[model samples]
Target: MNTASSDQFNEYASIYEDMSQWPFRKYIEIPSVFQEIGDVDGLSILDFGCGTGMYARWLKQRGAGQVVGYDLTEGMLNYARRRAEKEDLDISFVSHLGPELIGQFDLVLGVYVLPYATTRPELQAMCADMVRLMRPGGRLLTLPIHPVYDPHPNYYEPYGFRLIAEDPENPYADGERVKLELCKNGEQGGVFAWYWSATSLERALEQAGLRSLKWRELSASAYPDANQAPKELHAYLQRPHSIIIEGVRG
Candidate 1:
């Protein structure tokens, strides 16, 4: 894995929260996923790729017994620490991969992280490792980029690729457009992103020995913006911008 790419997130660590809640409004399905998982009270939760502890904070607010936030980036950890301190949250932040980490949890979450993996094999390995961290019957929930979207024109610009389908009828149909751009500040060239489809993700999870409990395509329509959103965002909102998958570790 490219440790540098993992660490690059630290650069934006401090303001990561502000970036999302503000103009981007890149709503991740953390709260909804938690609701679906149901009653985390007295359960230990692990937030894999818990960038800046956004969801961790949410978990704390919702009354989890213990919430551990893990990230490969030190920068993100630094900001996460500060955020936790500011909020007086007692969450623990671990700077390690799933395999390297110890202990088990009742619930594990990977929100907006797997797609950033350097390779498919790494993603698979990470999924396996995540399952390993869960106790039997524990739940592993993740939101990965829907593969139903159009393929990227170029491999390097995985994040920059847009969804080409106009009206997607099913998870297999392509309806929304997505653009992911990863570049170094002031540097014209840097490492790029890779995309994943839902089928590929399911295969990885199946290989990891996780049994799918539920799967769904989530878009803005699932929320309040069903009627009013820009054409691009509207299409993505109607089509699935993300695939929410819940599996039980057996």
Candidate 2:
């Protein structure tokens, strides 16, 4: 875990939900992708980077035997813990990364976590840790930012996506640089974001020694009530937001 990313998230913790509108997190993204991975009944599940415990709660509702949530930001975990307590859900929250905190689980989920990784090696290491914590035949599911618009210039414009490449390579090794456009009050501004194409993500997973089960482009339209969402939010969803990947430890 990078201290820089952790510090950034910690600062964002108090207003993270407000900034992200995380209350609707599950509703705005891929649910079918999770279903396609198969029934999770009686399986131990881990929700990696589980902000506010939405996925952890969802997993329990889906019949997971036990659900554990882990994140780097203590503030996020604080909110998650409160939510779990209110719901009376038996979910455990951890502030650490890697297998030591996770142990073995039948299923693991990483939602919108990869893009936040600061470097290619960091992403690869996280993937490896996920695999290490899974039992053989146990599945790993991740939703990563699509490579297409990563480091994109227009924060409000739609970013298309492409399939991840299988070959491994360093995502940040070349001196390639791109400006990231951010929106504040509908105003566009630039920031630096490391770009990772689908290929970069796949390479990291392969380097972790996980076997791919399925890979697909996921859109918000695939979810129930997608059409009924606010027009602005619906449009954002239609644009490539993320890619869903399912793999298993060999």
Candidate 3:
């Protein structure tokens, strides 16, 4: 992970939880994330790049036997530990992603974590590390920026952010960067992230000895109030803002 990017996440740690309530997350990302999770009961799970351990806590509540949340940011880890302590949840949050974290989990997952890999080596290292931390037959799930995503207003409008593509004609051409301008209550902030194509992601998984790969795009149907959405907005369900990749350790 890039040092500057890590710092940025630390700086945004306070607002991170609030962003979880963003329209896109509630209506699209969360649904898709849980769908990929399915049943975690009795499984020993690992949350890679866990920010504040939200998913870790959720998995524990879902009956996971054990949940370990690993993140590179200390600020996020501190928040995670505090929340878990206050709630009396038996989840562990660590600020390390190291070799000692090998072969101990039945399932490993991360939401919007891969974009932190700012280089090819970093990306490959992340995939390798994820597989190393999983047992044989253990599943790995990740939600990453969709290679096919575009700045279509109909879909992104409700999220209070505008996507500015550096290369409009070929924004999804593997390694492209997307700039995000976030708006909330008239305040604005900007950030950017990298996107990896499905092909590249698959290769990384394969190199890590994970197989039976599958991809699921984010959909509005994952939302609790999906049925109440206007008919015209149903089209947004088909246009994914993120992609979920799942595979099993070989």
Q: Which candidate's TM-score is highest? A: 3
Residue 152 in candidate 2, Cα distance off native in Å:
5.1
Q: Order of all candidates by lDDT, from best down to worst?
A: 3, 1, 2
lDDT of 2 by residue, 33-135 (tens): 5655578788898888887777788788778887889888787888889988998899999877544544588888887677666677888887887777788
Descending-TM-score candidate ranking:
3, 1, 2
For model 3, how does the per-residue alpha-carbon lDDT over 1-250 read when each residue is reduced to its tens digit? 6667666677556567677777667767776688778888899999998888888988998899989999888888888899999999999898776666689999999787787677777788889988999999999999887777765533565566666667877777676777766665454566677778888888988998999998876767644565576554455565656788999999
State each model's C-alpha RMSD to the native. 6.1, 5.7, 2.5
TM-score of each: 0.75, 0.75, 0.89
Task: Please report the TM-score between candidate 3 and the true structure.
Answer: 0.89
Name the lDDT of candidate 2: 0.65
lDDT of 1: 0.66
Better of 1 and 3 by lDDT: 3
Q: What tens-digit string does per-residue lDDT give for candidate 1 at 120-225?
A: 7887887887788888888988877666543433332222223333233432332132334433223222223345666677788888878855786554433465
Pairs that collide, model 3: none
lDDT score of residue 99 within candidate 1: 52
